[model samples]
Target: MAGFLVSCQSDARNATRIPPTPSEKLKSNWQKDAIDALTNNIRRKIDLDNSYFKRARIYFENEQYDLAINDINDAIENKDNVGDYYLLRGQVNRELNNLDAALQDAQRAEALQQVSPELYILMADILQEKKRFREAQNYLNRSLQMAPYDGSAYYVKGMLQSRIGDTTASLGSFKQAIDLNPRLLRAYQQNIIINNRLGNLNNALYYNNLALKRYPKDAILHFERGQFYNALNKSDSALLSYNKAAALDPKLTEAYFQSGSIYLKWKMHDAALKAFEKVKNNQAEYPQINYLIGVTLERMGYDDRASEFYKMELEKSPENQLAYAGVVRLQRREMGQYSTPSAREPAQPSAPTRILDTNRVQIRTIQPRRSIDMGTDTTRKVIIR
Candidate 1:
């Protein structure tokens, strides 16, 4: 019986394992499906990451900065390993004017890629906007070190130099940027301003004219031209330029103010009054506008109207010298002192004069002429009748 039991055990052991039955096969198939689902889920996660980044880029390019930020935020939250995720988030934050947040993200990106000049440039721009000139300069220098031929970095450095009152350096930087990329409009504009500040009107005009050639309808360029012309004392040309600027942009208060000032200086009271009136109606809080109106009115001999405007100006700016001067002049006029005839006699006609000699010219007749008799021993005085 034991031998028979051992033989049966051996047979059982040696028996071929049956292929999976239909139900078992179904179970096996189910297991395989589960494994495949898991594999697909992993791939989907990866695809989601890629898709988010792609969509975020699209949003950023379309100027939907908020959406881009949200998408990038999700991507980073899901997996913070991607350096580009942080970099893109930083760009979105910058577009939204969230400089602090942008700086933090950009710094993270810089940590991930030590040699990224683009990141340093972005940081430099934010620092520049915050007026952190020294810091901005340092970052710009770093960016330049990494990418020696970066036109944008040079342009930004130029602007930073200008803000810090380093004109020579600023000019060199701007020129370098222009040489690298001539399409930089801002560099051209700043170059003009620097030239103007240095009293290089010809260069200023030349560059300004160059800018105008590029942007013919730019009101700011025309306004700048007007300023240059005014500096040259070319009032007519200045007025024409100012008029063109004002016509191009009616809401430019400075242009109107400048036009009014030019007219006032030229004693074109009517035109000045019109310009000042526009300013008063458009921007009444401008104390100088009120003062200018008063001045123009006074010039036109409208004392009462001028006084009213002057008082209004004083109400706005109590210490305004122009308003006070206008008021004082108006008061003097009202008191009849400024315009009244002189009370002192018109000088009595001077006695007629005649040339007595080539060497001496004297009055021909006088109330009395006293002379001394030199020949007489006794001192004698003779009155020439």
Candidate 2:
């Protein structure tokens, strides 16, 4: 697994205070004239601050997370008391993988809006990232209490429960979210995964079907349904689902790989070769494709060709069990024995014939050893001569 870490700097300064709404115009006029002499200098600073925040929003929306963080840092340094500003900064920080900084900024936002469910949700997101499931649950619960109708809160809680392996609770939370709003995509995916884990394949198929209905072009949904069918040993259905997924999105490598495996099992060698060939071309570094190619070749009785592919797989993964097993099988077939020891065993003579042509027959009795050391470092001696 790769570790993603990010650093962030936040400004803790408060924004310039604004006068009460009733006196705002009068106070603005009174201050405007007096501050007019220094207006140009102050205006430049204010404009710079505004530009910083504007650029921050643009960068964030454009997914330039590092640039967004820098611009937001400048904006926060100028004035940190803006609740929305802190919220935006926290969002950028989270995108940058600076969960600690994100948590702090989110907490600051919460301080500004003490009962804001959005702030609590942000905090819960950070807690969940840190794997503090209990704390995350508390924050999510608080957010739900503040706004019971927030379907997103339920969805998030469901995700948190799923992470902690609490499938039952997760199912309830997902269903609640779905009940509130049927369009929660994350809930649908999570529900499917949880249902599959719980051996409720029928429910998984149903939810996956529903997800496909909503997201007709979603390759993942088709791929997941294909996997469920494959698990049930319904290869034809699995093949159709995989074909649909692959047709919708040719880049879905798992769909191709799985379909290839199914084709291989069914002895549809040509189809298996084609699927694995695509995987090889698209994802050359994947060792499994090489192993599969070797298997297909072995099935076709091309021992030499199969051996080459198996060797290629071993080059990528020295301890490749399938590659080694292929090598062993091929060697056995080539040498006409499963192992070298059996091939080297001396042939025994037919049972002594009891006939007049034998004239006189001398019988010798042989005794077997108590044990044999199949090979490496031991000896066995029989008492009989």
Candidate 3:
């Protein structure tokens, strides 16, 4: 999705007239029947009041971004001058993947109420997505000035700072975010990555384990721990962690892929093929699994099987260069399998050492450009700049 955190601000003067705060508790337990009743009632005879704005949070809490947008649209139609309604609409539009509408709403909200802290954070997010880093920083600075202890603001700041190669600043911001809200998984992920990049392995492990203690069954966290251990050349530990991750969530293809790649690198071609086999029937379309299996088969001296695997990979991914290259190598192998180092080498052996790439088999893990905080639940959030 686009790079904006989706949170709303109250319109000017409407904050004082609030019912029970949605932040303190959801308006209801996300009851769809009540939502439909309110929606139908409003559509039948729209109330020209701020109640729609308050009800929009219920839709958001229910993960009904489209319904939320419709509610906010009605709220704006009734009171176009309200800045909070505009902010609400902006957030709703962002969730609906309508960036233009989101920006328009944000601009309108700013025009109505220029000093809203959440509005500044939202602007920072939009600017960051547009690659306007300097302007984004200015917005984050303004947001921080207004809400110094806001964890979301600090998380956005950390994400932006990391984008600009300010690792130290970004780390500081993530630390502050964690200090504000220890359960912020993304902030912990960023801390682990940045410290590992700086070769502070102990620090990385420390932070990741801290989060794991709190979120033991988080498959993503275990996968990330595997990444850290792999980075430090702890192959056995990494493989165990990856296996644990795969066992926790059977559809975690990256765990299998990485484990297979590790086995391939270690010359355990049988174990490697077994791991790659586990990756084949996963749900998230692990495109690299077939090619990796082909490589593993080739390494095991089964050229014909390897060729079949390579051909299958090509069928799955026509533009797979490594699969094509593997086919070429198989075609030209006049001598035996162990004739040369080049003959034994895979076209793209998953790092040939570590299994850390920006793209995982399904989702990008650990690297926190996207979800650096706010928890990876059903919240619509973003990393500004």
Give the per-residue lDDT digits (tens) of candidate 3, residues 1-385: 0110011133326352333333444556324434554455456553533547756867765557877787777777777777788887777776566778788889998998656887888788777767888998998999989899988688888989899899989999999999997776778888988998898988999999998987888788899899989988999999999999998998888898899889889888888888889888774357677788888888777888889989988998999999999998888784544343344556544445666776655764586566556656657677799
Q: How do the residues 78-104 of candidate 2 rate in per-residue lDDT, one tens digit apiece?
A: 766677778878888876788888988
List candidate 2 segments past 4 Å from native: 1-82, 85-108, 111-115, 159-166, 247-251, 281-287, 300-304, 317-322, 328-385
Between prediction 1 and prediction 2, which has the larger lDDT?
1
User: What are the lDDT figures for the candidates, one per model?
Assistant: 0.76, 0.76, 0.77
TM-score of each: 0.58, 0.58, 0.58
Residue-level lDDT tens digits of model 1 in 130-202: 8988889899989999999988788889889888789999999988987887766677888998999899999
Query: Which candidate do you rate higher for TM-score, 1 or 2?
Result: 2
Misplaced by over 4 Å in model 1 are 1-116, 129-138, 159-166, 319-325, 328-385
Cα lDDT, model 2, residue 374 = 70
Model 3 steric clash total = 4
**Among all candidates shown, the one with the greatest lDDT:** 3
